[model samples]
Every structure is written in structure tokens, then in C-alpha cells.
Target: MTNNQPSPDGILRLINGYWATGIVSASATHSVFTHLENGADTAADVAIRAGISERGAQTLLDGLVSVGLVGLRDGRYRNTAEASAYLVEGTPASLSSFAKLKLTHMNALADLPEVVRTGGPVKQVATEVADNPHWAEVVPAIAAQSVPAATIAADVLRLPEAGAISILDVGGGSGIYSAVWLEANPDARSTQLDWEPINAIARRLLEERGVADRFTCIDGDFHTTDFGTGQYDVALYSHIAHQEGPEGNVEVFTRLRKALKPGGALVVCDYVVDDDRSGPAFPLLFASEMLLKSKQGGTWRRADYHDWLIKAGFEDVSFHSAPPATLVVARQRRRPVL
Candidate 1:
């Protein structure tokens, strides 16, 4: 092998990416980040604290060190600044819940080859929840990582004049949007609809945020639920449509049309693909993961959303200038009676 030979970037990235997954899984499984939260510890000490063999802990720590996610001082191991902030369990910035979700549902990744052949997520993910009750806990945990994105959704859903502004947050996991809106629009309150278990977490989060008194949790299947005709001044469906196929998308918007007051605004935040669906890596990657993890989910084009909005009686459908992920806002065509 010539030392001066140009590196093979494509093959190397694929090869190295697999190792990153293994490292993530190992650190999460051992709770290494949690272990190093306060300060560094020797490998043997970490093993004792975490109930693993000293040799195993040493190897894991060494791997973390090599990956630059952890560091060594003297003979002690510690999380790097980035890992310390976002992987430590109790930190507000922690994404440990998201990591745990991935670790718990690793079978999703393992079964990707089969999913490719069948062109669907394994039926069990949706249909066999009783056998997989663990998914209930994992789903809300996954949503917690996306709370920052929810803040953006809430900000856009703001109504200028608020005297009892009624809001509907559909499939609003963890109640982040409702929480933000209720905080900002003091007179405004919300109804958050999502799966029962996920809604439990949302209720708790809302209570913790001191907004539970202003919000109601509706634990039901949103597709079949009556979202209340002409009840809300604002409706938000954030990070949900892509998982529901085009037919479901139309059904949801149709429901929203009846739910909103005249001239009410609908705010949708999603990873929308360009009209051509050619690029923008996050949505494309998410699309692949969606295919691997959901039955009918796929990223939609921006134009498709405009068409859906128009079909559902929305006028002035427009995209936000910020964040290429696409924020679609539309107003009900009917003017509210003065």
C-alpha cells in the first residue's frame, strides 16, 4: 500500500459509519455518559459503578477515547464536553432518551434488509404493540429530542390577538408546541392528541411546565377522532404528516378544515423534500429511516403540501423563508364574521 495514495472517501465513510453505531450502542448500554457526568473516573471504578468487568469497561472507555467522545486524564476516563452535555441523563440538553429509544429498537436497523425486500416496516411496529409495549415508552423519549423543533412550530402558530385562542396540536408528541404556545399566549390553551402512553408523558411535561391546567390531553387515534368543528383558531400538525401517507395527509387536512374557525391558520412543520425530491440530506435520510421504521411514511414534496392545502379549502399556502425543512402555513378561505 502506497502511503501517499489518495484516500477512498466513499468506502471509508460507509465502513466507519458502522463503527459509530456500535460505539453509540455501547456507551448507551453502559450508561458511560451518566457515569462521567460529575467528573472523571478510572476504568476500574466505572466498571464497579456500572456493574461490568474492569477489563470490559477499560476496552469500552478506550474505544470511546479513540472516537473522541471521551477523554483520558492520568488513567481516568471522562466524557468529552459534547458528550457530557447531551448524553448525561439528567441534563436538560440530554438526548439520552433518544439514544435509549434507538438502543431499545435496534431491531429496526437489524431488520432493514427484510424491510427492503418487503418494502415496509415490519408489521409488528404498528399492529403488534401489545407484544412490544416497550415501544410506548420509547416513542415519547424520541420526541423529547425534537423539542427545539417544536418551539419553532409553536412560534409560527402564534395568533396576534388572543382572547381565548383555541388551539389543536395533532399528533403533538410530548406537548412541546402546546407548552410553548400556552406560555406565550396566556389566554390561549390547547388540546394535545396523541397515543395514550405518549400523551401520558405530555401531560407530565405540561404539568411540569405549569401549563397542564391550560391544556387537555386526548388519548385517541387521531385519524378516527372528531377534532371538533370550528373550535380552534389555530391548528398545528408538527413532524407527523410524513409518517402518514398522502391519503392520510389529505384526510388530516380535511379534518383540520372542519376543526378550525373561519380564517384560522394551520401550521405544519416537517422535513419536506424539494418538489423534485432530489436532495437535502436530513429529510432523505429520515425518509430512509421512515421506510425502515414505518408502514407508509415517506417525505412529501412542498408542492404536494400546497395541493393538499388547496384541496382542504386553504388559501395563501406559503412556505417559511427560514429552515429548508419547510414550514407550510395556510389560512382557511372563509372569512370570520365580524
Candidate 2:
């Protein structure tokens, strides 16, 4: 007789997830990927270049190899294509900083039990208070993560073909969408509304990308601030909905709908779960982060978005797949001709 029971392997992997995080974070911290890219093929070379012990370098490289981020052959190590593209420092698609940022966030997860018991964060660090300096460090790191999604959004909307469009990126953390859209359309201009500190980071980043002149920032909380009517051809609410409750999201969506010009599109990029919330593992896992950080935030479902957008006076709400994120595009209802 065969006993029916689930394998322990899956559970073991889930419990050991922190080990992978540690390995990646440590490697990124020591610039191991950068050293590997710079021709450090041996453990000793990596150790010397990254200023770690040879034993440590060997162990880290072995971990990276196991994780498929590094390749080992003939007693030599090299970055895999994925690592070369996204783990190396100064690469346009690099996520080294985001990796390092997650290391810092791991400590907060230790309070998960208590947070779940209490049904909210013990101490809220994810708020938009004036003195909060969290965004200063977080914005730029996440900018890299948003690149593919933002580029896809621009492509989906055909911003390049739109010609002379105006964009309002509400709570646009790093101004990446603005930067990408502006680059894709030379005649386009963007305005980002975020806290002053985050805006400062955005200004510097946009300036480096040579689009600062076309990017403007409004420093205020979106909750209380007015998103002017008929002011924008496109509006972006990216990675922000998960930090809000249903009421808050509806309110913001209503404001965004009003902010858009007639026929303008409102693009919402977020880690959206399926209607039944059965799978697409990342968004489900990410809900815990929201629980630990915000009082009323969670990974919302597709149905939730449809209801909110429709209630907010938007029409033709649709969802598009952008890996690591989902885009919900809605249009401002065009007024009928009298």
C-alpha cells in the first residue's frame, strides 16, 4: 500500500529560503558579481578583488552556482547570463542594490509572528510621514526592478507613437516611468508627485538620464493632495496599491480618473493576484510584506481592481501581464458630443 503524503522537499526549500537570500546579499555587498565580470575567474582572484577570504569567496561562489547565478567549470567561476545582466554593478538592468535592500528588510520579518498576531505592524516604517527617510534609500534600488515593467507599459500604450503626451506619475518613486516614457517620446513631458526627499532622488536620476528638463515633481501626499482634472494624457500608479486599503485605493483611483484628460489612460502597475487568489506565488507571498508594513494593505485581486476602477468612473478596465508586475489600464470616459 502506498501512503499519500506531500514531500518534505518543498517545505525544506521554503524554510531554507533565507540561505539563498543571505548568499545573494553577501555576494552583492562584496561586489562579487562585479569582480567576476572584471575577469576574476578563480576564488583567490575573487577574494583579493572583493576583499573577502578565499574560503568565503569559494563558498559564496559555490552558493551562487547552486542558485544558477554563477557558472563553474574547470576550477573557474563566471557570472551566468542572468547574473551578468542583472547582478553586476553599473549594468543598466542591475538589481544589486535591490538585493542589498532586501537584506535589510529580512530583519523586519523576524517580527512576522507578532505582526500577524496583532494584525498590523508593531512599528510602521512604510508610511509617508514627512520625516521618513526610507524612500530615499528604497526608491533608486527599486527603480531597476521597475525598468522592464515600465518599458512594457510604454510599449503597450505606444507612447512613442502618441506624440507630445503629458504624464502624471502619482507617487512615482524614482521617476523611472517618466524617464522611460520621456526617452521613448522626445516631445513628451512628465510630472512626478512624491515626497520631497524622493523627488530629490528622482530629479537627480532624471537629470543623469538627461530628461530632468521634461520632468517635474510635486511634493505632497497623494491622500490629501489634489490631482488636477484634465491635466494628463497618461497617469501611472505603480507599486503603490498594495500599501493601501480598499477605501484608500478607490479614493486614489477616483482622483486619478479625474486627473486624466478625456480618452487618457490610467496605468496601474502592481503585484496583482488572480481573482480567486489561488496562485501566481509571488503576489501571494508579497501580501505578508504588506501585512507587516501597513495597517490595511494586501495583494489585491483582479476582481477588486475591476470594482474599484469602475466605481472610480473609469471605463474599459483591462489587465496586462508584465512579469514581476501586472498592468491595469483604464480609460477616462470621453464626454459625449452635445
Candidate 3:
């Protein structure tokens, strides 16, 4: 291999990476940070608040201290600055929900050796994953992870101020993208398509922005949902396509294109790896998680998205990417008379 390749030392670190992940997951599951933030500075206090044993709390606390996520001094423990800012509940940047959501579902990957041998999620099918009880956690986690990228993409969208523009957010889990657009253009309206539970999550989020009045929710899967023809000026597949794979994306994109007005636009936001599928660490790692949750899910490249968009009757496709997320914009290409 070339000199660019790192030594086996790097691979060793990666292989053992799950040690810290497991510790983080365990601590977050027990709400260790929340207890600390709520004045439970000692392991005894933490045990009382979190309903775990003092011994267990101390073990986890010191483990987190070793990882630098928790601070220890004078027989008391507290969140590190990073942990307090992002792990404690009720903070603007709180990632508590994300931690819970990821760890909850990652339980499915407990038998990694079996999955590797079977070449699929050996425990459960994709549909069986993320049960109803977890829906609340799922959407919040998705929102926290996605809204930053969605905000950036919405700005890049540069939506027109025209009163006639309407948007369709396909598989819009949290409605952040369309909500951002509605905020940008007061006259614009949006409709989000997702499952009933997910739509409920979207409603809460959009309501927070007072855009609920301008946003409509469709209760069904994007695959089976009827998106009225020529009804929308823009359609978004934000963070949606990666879970569907190529053929599924083409199918959904075709239907989305049909739902657009003659010259409407389509926007796709997702994690995109390079065409060679080699590096750009984030998407590559994300694909592994997808393998555990989805049958055909994996990250796509910008070029692949461009090709799919063109084939799905879109034109002038363009690409933009901020690491861990990429946005592809295209316009509906009305077909000529046969």
C-alpha cells in the first residue's frame, strides 16, 4: 500500500473503539450526566438519583473520568465541560436523546460475529427495528443529528420569495428542512410525508417553530403515499435516500418528480461518500451502522445521486457537501410529447 496508509496501530484503536462506546452508552442509559447536572456530585448521590448501586455508579463515574467525559475531585464527580454542554438533559446542544436512541437500537448488533457470518442483521429485519416506544427518542435524536445540516442546506437552497412555492418533504422525519424554508419564505407552505408516529414527531417540532399552521402532515410511508401530481414547487428527500439503496431511491425519486409542478425542484440531503467509496470517514462508518439496521442501506456518492436524479426525470442536478452530510439539488424535467 501507499505511504498514505496508517500503521496497524490505527486499526487496533478502531477495533477497541467500542470499549469507550459501550461505557458511554451504559452511563447515558443510566442518566449519569443528568444526575451529576442535578447536584448529584458524589457517586452515592448519583446512585440515589439514577436508582443504581453506589458501587456501580462509582465504577462508571471513574470510567467516564478516564475517558475525560467526567471530572473527579474531592470525592465528588461532575460532568466535563463537553459532557455538561452536550450530554446533560435540557441543554440546547443536548445529545442525551441521540445517545439513548443509538444505544437502544445498537443492542441489535450484540451478536456482531453472527451478523458478519450471515451477511445481514441476524436478529431482526429492518421493519422490526425501532419499535413504537422508541419513536419519541428516534425523532428527537434524528432532529439533533440532522437540523444543523438541514439548516445549512436550507440556506444553500436560496428559495424564492414567490407566494406560489409549495414544498413536499419526502420521509421528512422531523420536518426541520421544510420548517426552515417556511420560516425563510412566509408565503410558502409545506407538506411532510412520513409514518403516523413520525408525523407526530414532526408536528411537535414544527409546532415549536409556530410553522405547524403552514405545514401539513401525511400519515403513511413515502413509498405508498399519494403525492398529488404537479402540486409542489419543491420536494425534499432529506437524509432519506441512503436507507433505501439505489433502486428504491430511483423509484421514490420518480414518484417525487411526478408530484412536482412542471418545473419544480428536488433536494436530497444525505451522507455521501466519494465515488471510490474509499475514505471521508463519516459516511463510511455510517454505512456500517446502516448494515445493522437496513437491508440495502448504505451511503451513496454525489455522482450516483446525480445519475439517479437525471434518470428520475430531473435536470441541472448539482451537489454540495458538508462532511457527514451532502445535498443534491435538481429540477423536474418535463417530458416531451410521445
Q: TM-score for every candidate vs. truth?
A: 0.80, 0.95, 0.78
| 94 Cα displacement, candidate 1 (Å) | 2.3
User: What's model 3's TM-score?
Assistant: 0.78
Please report the candidate that would top TM-score against the real structure.
2
Segments of candidate 2 deviating more than 4 angstroms = 1-7, 333-338
Per-residue CA lDDT of candidate 2, range 117-233, in tens?
999999955664755778778888989988888889988999999999899999998888898899999999999998888889999999999989999999998888999998999
lDDT of 1 by residue, 1-338 (tens): 38898779767867676566666667777787898775538887788777888898888787788778888877777788888867887765477767655655555677778888999976555532423566457655665555555556556655434668989999887787787778877788899887787788788888888989999988887888899999988898888888888888988998898899887888888888888878667787788778886788888888989999888878879887334466789896775569
Report the number of backbone clashes for model 2: 0
How much does each candidate deviate from the true structure in C-alpha RMSD? 3.8, 1.9, 5.0
Residue-pair clash count for candidate 1: 0
Give the better candidate number (1 or 2) by lDDT: 2
Any residue pairs clashing in model 3, and if so which? none
Question: lDDT of each structure?
Answer: 0.77, 0.91, 0.79
- Candidate 3 positional error at 19, Å: 2.7
Off by over 4 Å in 3: 1-12, 26-88, 91-93, 126-132, 160-164, 333-338
* lDDT pick, better of 1 and 3: 3
